[model samples]
Each structure stands twice: as structure tokens, then as C-alpha cells.
Target chain A: MQPQTAPSPQFSLRPPMEAREKFNRLTTWVIVAALLIWSWRGSEMNPMTLFRDAGNIGTLLGDFFPPNFMDWRLYVKEMLVTLQVAIWGTVLAVICAVPLGILSAENMVPWYINQPVRRLMDAARAINEMVFAMLFVVAVGLGPFAGVLALWVHTTGTLAKLFSEAVEAIEVSPVEGVRSTGASYVEEVVYGVLPQVFPLWISYSLYRFEANVRSATVVGMVGAGGIGMVLWELIRSFDFQRTCAVMAIIVLVVTLFDLISQKLRKMVI
Target chain B: MIHVTNLNKSFSGVKALSDINLHIERGEMVALIGSSGSGKSTLMRHICGLTAGDRESGQIMVNGCLIQEQGRINRDIRELRTHIGVIFQQFNLVGRLSVARNVCLGALSRTPFLKGLFGNFAKEDLELTCKALERVGIADKAWQRTSTLSGGQQQRAAIARALVQRAEVMLADEPIASLDPESARVVMSTLQELNRTDGITVVVTLHQVDYAIQYCPRTVALKKGHIVYDGPTANLTRAMLKTLYGSESDDLFGRKEEAPTIVQGAAA
Candidate 1:
């Protein structure tokens, strides 16, 4: 009788694989190494440098503690102004962004409308908010109004892109079903697309609002009227104590904004 | 009454429906039976004015209205759709919405925009929706999220939406294809009851000849975008099925028959 033999294992019969994959892996490693070297060259990212600078960081932290509550009245007023700027800027951005978001959505708008609106949004977003503030300060002559306008334009662009994507990802069946029922295009969008994405839109808008609080303070550094302007002046005079106080106030305000926004996001989404 | 003459539709240079002619009368349940890609769904879509074709190539008249003529479709096709209901295989329920809301959508075209925005459905509309839910035997589930329902229940909810639309003609595209045999029978019986009791015109596309014979009085068969047979359901013979579906006829209809009660139990 013939000797019993084991059956061969089944294997894929495709080619041994492409050299491109190996080349790609090597190229990725090379790019990563080059990026690390390039970043290290100018940043002085050595551990020794960090250790040597640790003392100065500690000194700064020590100065920040027992924060100067001496100008409590002035600080509270400035903090209120900063809060107002953020709130108004975000509200304005939301008003402007919603319509733009609808117009920019490829699924909602026709190509003729969407393409132009997207390009317009791209151009609007390309300019930094600080730059817009500087331009508006020059035109409107320095105030929270300029700062609010700057934040409005930048946030509108960002939120429009995000909200359009949200709109685009909605299930198409309900929209089609609604349209099939003799409903107008506007009605279909209102009923089918809006309900599905409204929660996500609210969540994203609240997230942007949190970011805008930080951005609003920074824009005030360019003489747009907030606590940042006072902090900038204190830093310019090298009054580290008062600067630390302003910084503390800013952190407290931003942290509060973050907590509120998080709560609202949870409720909405 | 609806009339379709010499209907032809093409997609991306491929013919999906060609030289098709059909006439559907009031209160008749016609089943369009065909294999996959045989253009049965496409034909049903055209009848409801969801898909448009060259008007010069064909004429479609619904209730004395010339809906399509000379490569042009009527602008009032939406109004035409109000008189017809469409049921999809997937049951197309918005997952997050309640069953009542899904049915309420059927009345939205008639309700003012502001009313719809606040979900201020008219009392009569609400009553009709509830009645529709009752008719489909899912009234107790009307307030529940549609996604919570079983496949059979979801399909019934879809039927309720169609009923609430007060549609005179119902077009079901492979309604039972996705259901188990028991659920399939339930849905088919529902359609049959609608046709027989309410005098609604029902045109449903089906894959199995057995269901078509059991539920529909008339049958239309298509193969490769062409109508191969159109006659009474009782006339569908093994030879005709063999001719239409080729050697796959046995594979299509032949099966180890299960007890109908077992199918019902599975559905429940």
C-alpha cells in the first residue's frame, strides 16, 4: 500500500507582491526621519536645553501664583467685555454660517451654486482672524466691533465647511421620499436634511463657540478691546505680576466657557 | 386608470426599459414578475413618475391627464404621485422618527410649511394617520421609534404612510423579496386586502410566481428589458416560466415547502 501523505495547505496564488510596497515603506521612514531632523535643527529641541530652561519656567509659575487680585474691579470689567466679545462674535458667526453652510453643501445646492459658494468660503477662511481684525481696526478705527467682525468672518468660513459636510452625510432616502410626495425642494430640505443633521450641527457650533472664546481674547491684543489688550500693555511694561493676573483671569474665563460649552454639547447631541 | 404606450428608458447608454406598453385599470392587483435587472422596478418607477422617459417615444396618461408626451414630462408630476403610493423593499423608515411622524409625512405636501415646522399636524390628519396605523395593525406602535419595529412591522408602517396619503394606486417594488415567507404572506395579504376591500389599484413586483398567483389577479413578466408575458396570473405555466426565466425556473420556484404556520410564527 502507498504511504499516507498530508494534504498541502491552501495558499493564495497571486504574485509575490509589488516592489512598490517595500519602496513606499522605506520612503515613509525616510520622510519621517527627515522631518524629525528638520524640526530639531531650528527648535533646539535637546533635552539638555529643556532642563536648563526648567528653572525659568518654574520662576514664571511661582510669579503666577498669589495672582494680583489688587485690580479686582478693573479685571472684572475687562473680563465681562471679553465674554461679550466672544458671545456676540459667535452669535454673528452662527447667523452667517448657517445660510452659507446650506449654500455650500454639494448635496443640497446645485453645482452652479455650490462651486462658487465653496470658493468664496475658501477665500474667506484663507485670511487669519488677526489679519481681518487689523484690517477692520484700520477701517472701523479700533473697538470690539472690529474684533467681532474678524471673528465672524473666520468662524463663518470654518463652520460653513463643517456644517456643509454634516448636511452632505445625511441619508438621501428621506429627502427623496419627501420630494416624491409633491413637496417642494425647500420643504424637502427642511424636513429631510435639517432634522437628521441638526443635533450634529448644534454640537459643532458649540465646539466652535469654545474655540472662539480663546480667539476672541487673542484678537483683542490688536487693540480690539478685551482683557488681552490690558495683558499686552502690562507685558509691554514688563509688569510680570499684573501680566500673570490677566493670564489667570483669561484661563479662568476660558475654562468656564469650555465647561458650559461641554454641557450644552451634551444636551444638544 | 393609467395607460403607458411604447415606454423606453435608457441609463448611461444601456437600455433599462424598451418598447414597453401597459394598461392598468382601477381596482386591479397586477403583479410584475421578473428576475433581477429585468426592469420591473424601473417600469414601476416610471408608472409613478419617479423616473422620466422620452415623451415622443411613449405616452403615459393617468386619469385623463397626459403626464408624459414627446420626450417631456408634466411639471405637475408631484400632484400625480399624490394619487399613487410607492413601497420599497427596504421599508425606508427614517430610523429616528416615530412611526406617526413617518406616516404624517404623507400629509406634509398638503400641510402648510409653518404647520409642518412645528409638527402641528391638523387633527384630521392625525386621525387619518392613526386610522392608517390601525389598518396596518400597528396602531399601538405608532408612537415608538420606527427603528424599534421588526422588518414586517416597518413594512406595515410604510403601508400605513401610503394609506395616509390616500393613494388610489399602490406600487410595491419587490415588497416581499426581503421578508421571510411568513412576513411575505402577511404583506401580500395586506396588499390583497387593500385591493379587494378598498377598491385601490395595486401593482406589485414579485420574484416568486407562487406569491404572484396567490395575491395578484393579473401578471406581467419582463426579461432583458422586454415584456415576455402579460396575462392572467392563472395562465403562468411551467413552460412559460421556463421560456421566460430559462432553466432557472425550477430554481426560482421549486423549494422544500414549509408549513405556513411556521412562517407566521417566525414573523411574529
Candidate 2:
């Protein structure tokens, strides 16, 4: 008691720390560094090579300066086919996905019903549309049909997953309100669940349709038959000028499609 | 009209209700009074077959039909639901749907299921709904989206749905817990009108003791999942309330200027 104790000082700008927290932070950084090294080696990533080859990319780009228009009609036809593929794929996805979406929504059904369906959807989503398109091209013998099938499978999985989440996030109180009316399970879903999630489902489907349009354009490179085949051919033949024209057309078409669909979606919502 | 005997309920092994034995005659208006987590809501839920009680603990019956026995709900509870209306504190309406459609949902069970999905509500049902909306004084907002309506209006719309359901017994779980004083008065008055005029049995859980006395003739006080008091609302003396609740009894009431010991415990 003879020695007077000092009161704690006021707060300062410098951060106060615990040694344990500092050690944890260092360990995290070490783990992150190790993982980065492992991934770089595994993927064979070399930034130096990309930097060195940057001039060749410029040279390759320069070759496409003046685009050729001789193949305009063929490009337009292929482009339209891509659009049709997108539309068909989206329609199929909507019809199939809506049911699967409802089935997979955990809140809608019990674990036994939704769990297996969700796992099956996971398997569908794990494969890219490009991979599916490649398989479909072999099976269907190379046409827009193959592209459409690939987009349909992939988009169904995606939209179903999205729609299920929207279903899960819906206000449970209204569903309870519906249940108190003695509405059957199907009736509850139709009146209570579907009405709440419908707008969100529509918006998600519209967004997925736009992505499928882009996918349809490129799936043709794997012999799934769309504008991608023409673009792929020009690239392979070193007809860079015509490739530029196709790229320009793809840009214009995708933008227009996106704009129109967005407008429609806005109106519906 | 309602019978609950030897009821016990627990969630995750924690007791929410315990040994509740209550009987209410048809056309009686009762108020359930308690602080938070006092099992008033649990009792109401049990009556409507929304939640099940402990196995081998109790049975609940409505109009001589067993709702649940030994924690098992009867499979034919759907038919029973047509006669009971449950209103929540949140005013559980499908917000995106029109107010009229939300009300029309009460008429769904009466209509064929397939036709209900297609929204083939009958002309008579629509007229009934309009009459219900009129009863709630929201006929002008019938076709408007329910979400657009204010909280008090939405609660009225919910009551209208109950009227449309032709529910004999109404269970309101803190119907005006979120509303302002003026709105709360309107909502309580509407429930009062239903009880006095239509002779509908209304069991309302209330937070404010003043409203319990002002509106409901009878109040059942619950504490720790057990009924501490069940008698005329006028008999809820300050000392009784203090015994029922502790220091927290102060917040359970509003407008304390009136004498609490004035026992107007007249039996109706």
C-alpha cells in the first residue's frame, strides 16, 4: 500500500494485441502462402511467360483490324440458330426446373424427398455446359440440338438451385397462414409458396436465359452447331479479319438479347 | 367448445407448457395474460393442432373430437381447421397477393382443391369476402396488394379472412403486440364486436393487462408454463399481478392511474 499504483492510460491510435492472436494471424498467412505455392505448381501458372508473350497477343489482335463481310449471311444464320438454341433451352429449363426446384426446396418437402433430389442436382451442376455439349454432340451427331440439350441440363440445375433458395427464403408465416386454412400440401405450395417465390423465379430464369445465349454461341466450337463453329473455323484457318466481324456480331446480338429480356423481366416483376 | 386436459409440452427437452387443464364453453371470450415465454401461445397452438404436447402426458379435444392424444395429432386435423382461425402478431398474409385474394384463401378448403389452384373462387365466395372486408371496414382496399396496407389495416384484413372462414373459434396470438395504441384499440374493438355480435369464441393472448381488463371479461394468467390464475379480469389486483409477475409486473400494464383493487369481478 506504500507504493502508489498507476491508473490505466487513455486510448491511443496504435492497436493493442494479444500474442495468441498475433501467432494465429502469422499461421494463417503461412497456410495461405503454402496453398498459393501448391496451386501455382499444380496449375503450371507462370506470370513471366504471360508477360513475355503479351506482344504476340497485340500482333494477333492487329491482324483482325479490318473485318471481312463476305461471310455475313452465313454468320447471321448461325447467329440466329444460336438465339433459337437459347430460347429452346430456356423453355425446357423452365418447364423441368420449376418442378425440381420445388422438389429440392428443403422447406417445401421433408429431407427424404429433397435431399436426394438436391444431391442429383449437385451432380448435374458439377459438369459444365461445354462438357455436356461435347457429349451431346457425339450422341446427337452435331447440330443446334446438341447445344440446346447441353444448355437445358446445365441451366435446369442452376435455375432449380436458385429457385429452391428463393423458396427456402420465403416468409414461413404466410405458409403457416395457408396451412391453417386446411389447404392440402399441393394447395399450400400453389397458393402460399409459389406466389411468394414467383417473381424471384422469373427474374432468375431471365438472367439464366441470357447466360445460356452466350453458351449457345460457343458450344458450336465442340461441334454442337451454332455461330461458334463459324468463328472457330475462321480462327483455325487464320482468317482473323472475318473472325473480328463474327466477334462484333456476337457482341451486338448478345447485348440486344440481354437488353430485351431485361426489359421484359422488369415489366413482369 | 374447447377442452385441454393434462397438457405438457417441451421443445428440445425444455418445458414450454406444463400440466394445463382448461375448459371453455362455446361463445366465450377469454384473454391469456403472461410475460414472454409464459406458454400462452403454446396453449393456443395446442388447441389448433399446430403443435403437439408431451407423449403420454395429455390430450386436447375440440367439440368432442380429439385433436391430439399422447403427442400424436390426428390425421384428419384438416377438417378440424376449417372451424378454427389463428391470427399471428406478424399479421401473416401473403403480401404480394391482393387483399381480396388473401381473404379468399379462407374459402379455399370449401372449394374443390384443383379449382382453388386456378383461382376459380366462386361468386358467392367473392361476395362473402367483400362482406368480410366490409365488416373489417377495408372494402376499398380489397383488390390492393396486402403488403401496401398499414399494420392495423392488415390485421383487420386478417380478421376478415377469419370471418370468411366462418371460424367458430378465433385464437389470436398477441394480435396487437406491434401496433400503436390507437390501432390496438381498433383491433381489440373488432375482436370484441365479433365476440358480442357473432358469438365467436376468441382466445387472445395479451401483453398489456389494461387491454385484458378493458376488453376480455375473463383472463387466464400463466407463469412458467403453468396457469397461475384464471378468473374474471376485474379480479386481477395489483398484489395478485405482483405475485404473478415480479418487479416486471409494472411493464405488463399501461395507464396505472386507476385503482387496481377495485374488484368488479362480476360473472357474466
Best by DockQ: 2
A83-201 per-residue lDDT for model 1 (tens digits): 78888888988888888999999889899999999988998789998999999999898788888888888889999999899998988877766665666677777767887888898
**What are the clashing pairs of model 1?**
B55-B70, B55-B71, B56-B70, B56-B71
Best by the lDDT measure: 2
Model 2 agreement with the true structure over A51-165: per-residue lDDT tens digits: 8999998898899988887889999999999999999999999999888999999888899999999988887888999999999988988899999999999988898899999
Candidate 2 chain A minimal-lDDT segment of 10 residues: A1-10
Whole-model lDDT for model 1 versus the true structure?
A: 0.84
Over B160-195, each residue of candidate 1 has an lDDT whose tens digit, in order, gives 888878888888988988888888888999999999
The per-prediction i-RMS, to one decimal, reads 1.7, 0.8
Candidate 2, TM-score vs. the true structure?
0.92
The candidate maximizing TM-score is 2
Candidate 2, residue A25: lDDT: 94
The complex in candidate 2 yields a DockQ of 0.66
lDDT of 2: 0.90
Q: Model 1, which residues run further than 4 Å from truth? A: A1-17, A31-65, A139-141, B54-56, B254-268
